[model samples]
Target: MIDLRSDTVTRPTEAMLESMREATFGDDSRDGDATVQKLEALAAERTGKETGAFMPSGTMANLVAMLAHANRGGEVLLEDGSHTLNAELGGIAGVAGLFYRGIHGKRGAMDPDALREAIRPVTRYHMGTALVWMENTHNRSGGAVLPLAHMQAVYGLAREKGVPVHLDGARIFNAAISLGCAASEISQYSDSVCFCVSKGLSAPVGSVLCGGAAFIERARAYRRMVGGNMRQAGPLAAAGIVALETMVDRLVEDHQTAKRLAEGLTRTDASLCDPKDVETNLVRVDVRKSGRRAAQWSADLKSKGVLVAPADLYALRFVTHRHISAPDVDAAVGAFAELWKKS
Candidate 1:
């Protein structure tokens, strides 16, 4: 199947698998794992941060970041559709004992004024706001790329209020490529950032959380508390290292393929969002006019040997990844055209 469901469906490349096979193992609990240490250092340097802690998933990374940055009963300001708030199973509230104040953002880019408004004044009667969270290439919003200026403005607001900012940069590389900038540029505005290696980077598994040394030291303890500690984790870290070193630059190709898919989908009778908004690898299409629910459309597409996702009642999503080549994109487009004509 031409799985356009999500970038997380990608598998490791042969080189990554070989690196994993050749990786040496050591005790991660004792901080004696050479491969894990190297991966952490590389991730930290890439993001211009003081240190990094590798975790099993992006959820764990975000949870650890929240736990490290905010005390129990503290509140966090976040975009309403942010992964940390909507997709991480409410880890902030459930595991970290933090409250969330959500503000709606346009096209996944939170307004600085809105964020400032969301922050609560320090009072003896209220739980104090502790952190501001944001996501780049926001998943629920069709992978919209959050503008760097917007992030900087939010960061400025947070700095003035003495509140920390944490970025759920799960697809920051995709945003960087779309914006024609370095990932570190995005990271500069965030006090802490978490990025996934298993998504567009094509690693089998892993995410890295980067921040100041003291913050990361605190996060390490949270990592263990969350059951993210791994012994002999070098094999996974090896794939992550290769993903960081080699896979980032290729995200532009995925963006291009998504653009192609969006263009083709729009040519059909199905109502779709702007193809120009297809800035990254995700294309969210409105299919209500096609007289099919998103779930039915997904099933139809799957039967035709193509795979996508039903994001909502009126929308379906197509996500391009490293495994989906240009030809696969063309085939997906053709399948959509055929299905639309028949429907």
Candidate 2:
């Protein structure tokens, strides 16, 4: 089957598998595993941060960031369409114990003016803004990359307000590839950043949260509180090491394949998607015009050996990764085209 459902569906590479076999079996929670420390240091270096802590998933990393950065009842401001706000299952509020105000945005970028106005000082009548948040290669907006200028503006405003900034950079490498820059270049705008190796990088599992040494130290405590500690995680960290070293550069191919998929879908039906909006490995197809729900479209495509996920009631999200190729994209597009014709 052509699994366009999500990059999370990607399996580890042979190199990663071999590394896992040769990895140490040290307990990360007690004596501090050498392999885990190596992966954290590498992640920190790649993102230009002072230190890093490994987490089980991007959601936990993000939640730990919020917990470490803000007190309970503090407010977090992020783009309305961010994966943290929509897809992370409300961990921002329920687990981190923070209130969030979703700022108006376009293509996953929060308007600087709106963000500036929303930031407030603590008063008897109100809670102050505790943190500002950003997402790169935004998931819900067809994998749109936030322009550096936009990120700078937001980061500047937050800094002026004395609010810490956290970046949900689950697809940071993808954003970097699309922008022709290093991941650190994109991560530089925020005080803290998190990225997943399990996505396009094709690691079996793991995400890394990077920030100032003190901040990451605090995050490690929160990671333990949230049950994110993976004792004897050297094998997983070994795969992550291989992913960081080898999987990043080839991400451009996934971006190219995604663009091709978007172009083909638009050719079949203009209303489905605009190829220009696809900057990375995700394609958001508008199925509303087909007089059917996004779930129906997903089900229909699944039956034809192509799999996708509904982004919302009216949109379907297609993701490309190392497992997918040009012919796979064409076949998925053909399935979508067939469904379109019937509709």
TM per model? 0.97, 0.99
**Model 2: how far residue 94 lies from native, Å:** 1.0
lDDT of 2 by residue, 1-343 (tens): 9999999999999999999999999999999999999999999999999999999999999999999999999999999999988988999999888999999999999988888889998999778999999999899999999999999888888888899999999999999999999999999999999999999999999999999999998999999998999999999999999999999999999999999999999999899899999999999999899999999998999899998999999999999999999999999989888889999
Error of 2 at 290 (Å): 0.8
> Scored by CA lDDT, what does every candidate get?
0.91, 0.94
Error of 2 at 336 (Å): 1.3
Mind sharing the TM-score for model 1?
A: 0.97
lDDT tens digits, residue span 1-343, model 1: 8999999999899999999999979989885799999999999998889999999999999999999999999999988888788777888999999988888788887766777777876799988889999899899899999988898898888998899999999998999999999889999999999999999999989999999999999999999999999989999999999999999999999999999888877777536667988889999999888878999989999999998889888799899998888899889989988988888
Model 2 spans > 4 angstroms off: none
Q: Residue pairs in steric clash, candidate 1?
A: none
Error of 1 at 333 (Å): 1.7
Model 2 backbone overlap count: 0
Native-to-model Cα distance after best TM-score fit, residue 12 in candidate 2, in Å? 0.8
**How far does residue 286 in candidate 2 sit from its true spot (Å)?**
0.3
